[model samples]
Target: MKAKELMDKEFVYLNCDDNVVEVSKVMEEIRRFTCPVVNDNKQLVGWITSFDITKGLREGNEKIKEIMSSYEEITTIHEDAPARLAVVLTANNKFVTVPVINDDNQVIGMIRSCDIVELLSELYDIKVYKLYEAMQHQLKGVTWEELMSASALVSKKTTGVKISPEDYEANIMNATFGEAIWATGGLEKFFAGLISVGEMVIARKVGKARR
Candidate 1:
């Protein structure tokens, strides 16, 4: 898989002159937290996210350029780069979406975290197991929708194991701040055992259940 295959071509973008209010509106309309900022020549400039808009609104009159993450500092991958590299970059950068640029440094698309996870599933034939592992540690204070999405992914990937509503509720109960740490600890132990036993599928299944 290549960056181009995983990148979302129709991503939301903004102009440098776009104000915080306008940016906020765009975010709302697109239902996305961030937008790539570009110059008149369509060159990547910076990124404006919901966090930037809110911070700017609170501070009042701050320019978009002042709050946006400058494109120069953003981690960008070329279209032909290996998909594995994109996954590694995402893991290191802690960014949900990474910009993909052409040879001219023009922003062409974005590789999202979901895209990487999907590719991992296809490449590894492990269904949503990898997604479960990656997201399990971050489930604290997560929304019900997100939890249900995890469940759906697991159900899709596995055979003979239906993720019932009761299971989802149980997982949500275990994911509360009060219980999440201990549950995650158990998951880690399970992962270690799976590694030692060469039971990758079981590990994925267990991770999905715990997630």
Candidate 2:
């Protein structure tokens, strides 16, 4: 598949000068951490996220441009580019999605992580699910964020147990991190183990869907 094929044209974006507070509402409404930033001409100018909002809020920055990852700071893929490039871009830069552009460099659509995940599942005939969905029975009404936050505290003091996103996803239910989660005293934690705070961030990333 190519970027144009994978990209979603019907997606939410933010204006470069939009209020910082607006991005928070956008993120909340879209249930996504990131959004493409565009100029008045609708050309891709940058990107913004909850992380930027937190930083901007701390510094009292009111404009999206103040904290957005500018064009020079992000990697955009051509509409016809191979989809795997999006995977590489996200892997190297921690982007949740890649903006797809036309020959004019106008923002046309986006290749989201969830799109990639769905494609992979289809191509491989593998069963994949959001961790939160998979753990519905285990949660017992406790939110994933709460249980994850409680479990995430384990890495702060533990000496040397690092779990990368790839490792955690591939072995989340079986990872030794479960032990640490249990250590954190979460009554509804997954696998009854502990994990890294970093992976908790990754867990959230994996939880979102395109729709």
Candidate 3:
């Protein structure tokens, strides 16, 4: 995976002339702790964070260039670079986000530490049997409405198991994460698959008990 593949295209970047007040609003809207600063040429000049804004306030409203961390202090990764580079950079620098740039040094996206964590978590763990057992033990009384909602999600997403819920529960219970993703279609499909399968099993049990 490349940095661009994992980076968030929707991010906030400010011009050198931008002020704290405007920067704060943009940051709040994006729910980001930091953002990059750029010059008129769209080349990265520096970056700023909430901390910079706080310090700037003490000195009164100042231009972003005046409050921003110097370009050298901020690190950037090329969009074509390895995805792990973002994780390594963030881990080493204690960064919550890193800027992704193209060859022209124009900011294209932001790589978030949280996104990397999610991808890693999905990719690493493979205890499908444990997950299935836990689901069976814990989700015994899960409601029909919840199951229906999951079905709706799968239908809308067009990503989960196309087989009937019964088959999904029986056959795919022990499928590894990657296998499940392949069987389904994407990462989001796994949750919906779980719900749908669980629903089918519980519904069968309830029907048998009634008879």
Poorly placed runs, candidate 3 (over 4 Å): 125-211
Q: lDDT tens digits, residues 108-144, model 1?
A: 9988898787766553343333444445444444444
Q: What's every prediction's RMSD, in angstroms? A: 13.9, 17.2, 13.2
Give each model's whole-structure lDDT: 0.68, 0.69, 0.77
Q: Highest lDDT among the candidates is held by which one? A: 3
Candidate 3 per-residue lDDT, tens place, 1-211, comes to 9999999898777998887887887888878898989887778889999999888878896688888999888789999999988989988888899999999999999899998888888764575545666765686665444454444445445644364545444543456777766656776777766666676667766777799
In model 3, residue pairs whose N, Cα or C atoms come closer than 3 Å (at least 3 residues apart or on different chains), thus clashing, are none
Name the better of 1 and 2 by TM-score. Answer: 1
Better of 2 and 3 by TM-score: 3
- Ordered by lDDT, highest first, the candidates read 3, 2, 1
Superposed model 1: Cα runs more than 4 Å off: 123-211
Name the better of 1 and 3 by TM-score.
3
